[model samples]
Target: MDETQPLLPDPDLACDEAQDEAAGKDFVDFDPAGDAENPMDWPEAYKWGIVGLLALMAFTVTFTCISVVPVATRIVDDLDGGHASRSASVLLVTIWELGEAAGPLLIAPLSEMFGRYPVMNAANLLFIAAVVLAALSRSAAAFIGARALTGLAVASNVLNPAIVGDMFPSEQRGTAMSWIQLAPLIGGAVGPAISGAIAETLGWRNVLWMSATLAITCEAVFLTCFRETYKVAILRRRAARLRRETGDPALRTVFDVEGVSRSQKLWEAITRPFSVLAGSGVLQSLSVFGAVSFAYFYIMATTLPDILETLYGLSAAAAGSALISFSIGSLVSVAICNRALDGIYVRMRDANKGVGQPEYRLPLLVFGGFALPLVASLYGWTARAHLPVPLLIFTVGVMGATMLLSFLPLTAYVVDAFGLYAASAMTVVIVTRCLAGTFIPLASERLVDRFGYGVGLSLIGCFSLLFAPIPALVLRYGPKWRQRSRYTREAEAS
Candidate 1:
């Protein structure tokens, strides 16, 4: 460990066969942004615990956002809106997601420059303040601003899965991801019901207050439970701490390259995600699929309560209760996938003689692609036709299948394909998904109005069916495609 000796190469970059190449590379002069003591190498139990904690944090933020819209009518009444009241009311929900959509494009890349903890901690604080501000707002402008701030804070929720990917081995990714996907599903389903009840019993303002309280609580939990998992960040911090204790400024750490300055490294850290996205086919494909699914979820979320309350003569509380079916569907899918995904992985491995590849994750995606559009078609048609409540519930059942099938594949594929830069790849996923979530709500009512719910839903279903061929296409050409990717090579070399 001589100061002048070149540091060892990133262990993650050096797989079983690449160890020799790693040894011959003069250790690449350690850079924290690229160094690799990734969380994926951690013990299984510890990793799963981290996954559970992050999932809870995600659930809390997402739950609060979706629920707030159900009580928008009450808030609008309290705000004394004239003709513009309706537009103002809708902005409260839309602004939050719009802000969230902007975050990864802005803040996430910075996390790689600094560290995950700093970004997460700052975002959590922003979320709490935004919620508090919204609670105190007496005007529409104030309310809209508060919601935007909250969305900025909630944007970090996108990074949690990337952290989990960093923490667990790729083979065991499905189970950990189950919790991640499950949290959002549960949140989206339960948000309206719980918010509706609270709004009725307490007040619309109290809903934001309650949300602030939850945000504060989650911030505390994250501060206590979360650690810096981005290995390079951990090393950088460790190096600083060591320098402080020893009072030796000359003490070198793994990432302290002689020529490259920290600022240069920071620039690269911030830019790498975009660089990869521009260069890698795998990343581009997964992000597209992930974003589409996210858009569909948000569109459905914004529309469902409105449809239930207006068309079905259901009370706000009852309309919220109807979402329970969606939650049930999500849970059922997770349960089934958790049991089946590992077996699926093993079978793929056996078939390929242990040369496991990313294509293995696609089968689940295929199942989801088929289920999602069909469920949308069912829900749209059944609800529009004024069919029996049982039929609507059956649509929920179909949706559950879609959620189950899609969640594992996109997640697993991204983790396996992205290597150490999984966070950046996921950031792209987050940006696109949140954008879809934000934009879909704005146009969903219009789509339904113009085409009717059944037709609109069926159209979405057809579009989703087009995505079904993605997995097969990727399965056939994925590795060959990866071989041509410059970012993939950097990832493999990392």
Candidate 2:
């Protein structure tokens, strides 16, 4: 084979393991004979194409996460197992987030043990089936069950960063990560916009059907475009092939370098997140801050329709249309992040004697931390006062922009902080985030009812104010902590 030829010529990878000891023989399992078999050695076009597909997958799963919000009332009426309150009906959203919090705990480890493809494809299929069940549901339990399953499946998207790290070197990771960051927000934003319109015109069930269609479309794209990005899965295939070709059961891969067994690997994959999360003050603080911020973000997002509908008396479709501003704001904010995030990191690195640290991502968050809460308060109070349509939308837009300003950097910071274990660290981020999404907003409805939109939103914004110092703390003290820890020190040393 030509040294330059792509190791993964197809999406399906044939990988391997090893038990070789001859000084002249290849002893490394799935060893890159040169740079040829390394994921980083793939052509840029292939790397980026894979990134695009992964982003689409993330978007599809996230879109389903909140798509039901616009039609919560309709679902309540259509499937009355008993007298479920409006709030109780909308708890389905929380149910989904609940599932998301646990899904990564189970699926991500399996993805490590097996491969990303089998896990991801199976999850996507379950998501599709869940959507159908939601659409055809005859009782609240069935629909809520489906929503929880959907949440569980969607958590797979949280692992996409591992693939980015697998393919892109540190220099190119920021831009690609920024793009992946947009998927969840964009998916969350667009879902209600389309679902509200569909529910108003076609029926509530069509909202789920539309989401199902999107799942199908994204899965097709995934099947065609994404190769097995997991190193173990790829090398395991290679090891298997080598064993078959040479009839040597003695062959093994480098994963055997430490004599780690399948059970031990599985145990490590499962327990590491919790242990690391508990051990690292950095991960703990980041998880809490990220969770609260995201909870409030979703609180604002899911409740916007309710606010607009109650305060301004807009129709379902109009309220949905109003949400376009949020989506627009989120999309524009991501574009800015994609363009500026890497530039900022590169510039700061250049100015600091060619040094790079995760904290370099913090300066943007400093601005975001203070600005987002203030603007979010404005959005809340403006909605409370029933302010002019233009002003409300603009305030919400600014909130969207500031939200991503902090949100995008935090994920990148964790990726940089954890390096090879970015996926494990990300599980904590995802779990904290989903916990917030699942629970915090459950109170928003009552909060708004009691204090009105302005006061309620201001309350949430106050929490943002409280957590604002997190990035700065990490910026100032993060290096020392990294030096103390094994994982991040490895990142820094490398």
Question: What overall lDDT goes with each candidate model?
Answer: 0.68, 0.74
**lDDT score of residue 467 within candidate 1:** 65
Per-residue lDDT of candidate 1, residues 1-84 (tens digit): 211111122323324324532455322224435334446445667777788878877887877787876767567667765434
Give residue 312's error in model 2 in angstroms. Answer: 0.3
**RMSD in Å for model 2:** 5.0
Q: Which ten residues in a row have the lowest lDDT in candidate 1?
A: 1-10
How close is every model to the real structure, measured as TM-score? 0.86, 0.90
In candidate 1, clashing pairs total 4
Single out the weakest 10-residue window by summed lDDT for candidate 2. Answer: 1-10
